[model samples]
Target: MRKNTVGTAVTLCAAALLTAGLGTASAAPATSPAAAHGAQAQRQPRQPVLVDCAFQPQARPDAFILACGDGNSRLASLHWQHWDGRTAVARGVNLVNDCKPYCAAGKFHSYPVVVRLAHPEPWKKRPQVRQFTQLSLTFTGARPAGYDRVVTLPLWS
Candidate 1:
């Protein structure tokens, strides 16, 4: 009877160890699902989208028309003269309307403009622009004496 009691105690102890091992293994698999989700998130990075001013004029001021009339002010053409990934120089035309009396009877005007695109620094405080933060427009040729030569517009309204 003494030998039988000792054997029963050893068997119980072995069963407890086996159960504990199985529990650890099952828990490891459960944790792997969460780990896989984390890996997937890390694999996907945020992609930057290029600005299209025709659709979002206020968002992309660099390519927007001045003095909009009946939503007719738009970027007619853009010829990229120089681009080095970070900065770009382009020549474009802003088809705007000179609202002499009002928008209903406004005349369309084509303005030649120089476009410059610059990447924004992390410390800049432009909440309206995303991706590229600095967009400057300089009107080519002659302009009004008091008119500004360079106009920096927000990427967003």
Candidate 2:
């Protein structure tokens, strides 16, 4: 019985390898722009060169936006910036109840689209710069208030 099992395992392994090789050999050429760049060979997704801002309710900052996917909302501050020279800003308004429909908070609200803003210029700390470059929002309210998360556009890596 043991020998039979071993033989079966070897056969399975050989079949798997053969199938893999054949699959690759028979596959058509990549047609996407990414494929043209030979990136498919490495099996990596094209990372967007833009900043993303959202609130994480589990990581902390109970009422604010957090960077990484944590539940807490307080730490929900502007955490990352991309190469698109865009940063995100919170709508600035806080929801009276996290349960409100479209509220930044939702039931199981595991993933709520928080506030995000982007600036075209490199994110530079200057007390004088005003007017954001580009703005996109997934927020609870229209008025930017106390619990919103806002960040400057990323000019750096």
Candidate 3:
């Protein structure tokens, strides 16, 4: 049983890497004319985005990971109500793992939430991309244990 659990974790991690590699290049920011001309200052303001673990900039993704190193927490069934150059708003379900005995044996729990992305700043790792620096989730219904009705976390830059 222990061996089976390890195998499952390994398989899930492998799948994540594969999917990230196979993701569409269209998800990356397009090089604008100004960018091509090396006119960094003249470039039009690009839409703020959220980068996945793959480091791909996504304008409005259906799902997003809250924990990047592991697949323990994520936002699912995202329905974006607004996405502008500055901020984003959405309604989604926060799926979190309750790692009881262990992470591999954990059970996932769902919490209905209102999602907000704010503070658009140039990503330190990818300067060309404007990434949302913060994430705020207001739990509309159930939430993870030891969490507040509203939880705000800093997104990976």
Candidate 4:
């Protein structure tokens, strides 16, 4: 009778441990649904803000630099020829650094470029006059051998 009582107590202890482990396992999945929704929210891309091209005439607004704040890429040395309510035509140099090994230790290259900004799409979010929908760039004269003549980039709000 004494041996039977000891065995029964060991069995009860093992059963209690297994029950506690299953309780913790089930609780982990209960929080997973909320975590999944939070991950989905993070996957959405934030809209890009519109920056004004109009700078002071003395400031030499030659280039429309699309730095995007990171300083990785930009348009350099732009001389605006015409800018109306609908279109802007400019001649500039597109300075891009090929960040091969790393960004800080990259070599900057200059290419002669003719940039045109047009296609005014209304920003439903801002509804402003200066906002635009597209920007087109044409590398003229002597660009790198295999580069495209025209590249259209979307400007979205």
lDDT of 3 by residue, 65-94 (tens): 888888999999999999998889999999
Model 3 poorest 10 in a row by lDDT: 37-46
lDDT for each candidate structure: 0.59, 0.39, 0.88, 0.64
Q: List model 1 lDDT by residue over 1-157, tens digit each.
A: 9999999999999999999999988877454787887876454323222344343312223454443435656665777776553666778886666666886698877778887777733322333333445668788965334448887765532
Best TM-score among the predictions, by candidate number: 3
- Report the C-alpha displacement of residue 87, candidate 2, in angstroms: 7.5
lDDT of candidate 2? 0.39
Supply candidate 1's per-residue lDDT for 29. 45
Off by over 4 Å in 4: 1-60, 67-69, 141-146
lDDT of 4 by residue, 48-119 (tens): 223433321112255455556556556877787876657767788887766767878977778888877777
Task: State the displacement of the C-alpha of residue 82, model 2, in Å, after optimal TM-score superposition.
Answer: 15
Better of 1 and 4 by lDDT: 4
What candidate 3 gets wrong by more than 4 Å, as runs, is: 1-45
* Candidate 1 similarity to native, TM-score: 0.48
Ranking by TM-score: 3, 4, 1, 2
Error of 1 at 112 (Å): 1.3
Query: Which tens-of-lDDT digit does each residue in 3-120 have in candidate 2?
Result: 9999999999999999999999889675889666685533322222232243111111224433324443322333333322234333233223344464355443222334454444
Per-prediction RMSD in angstroms? 12.4, 12.2, 18.6, 13.6
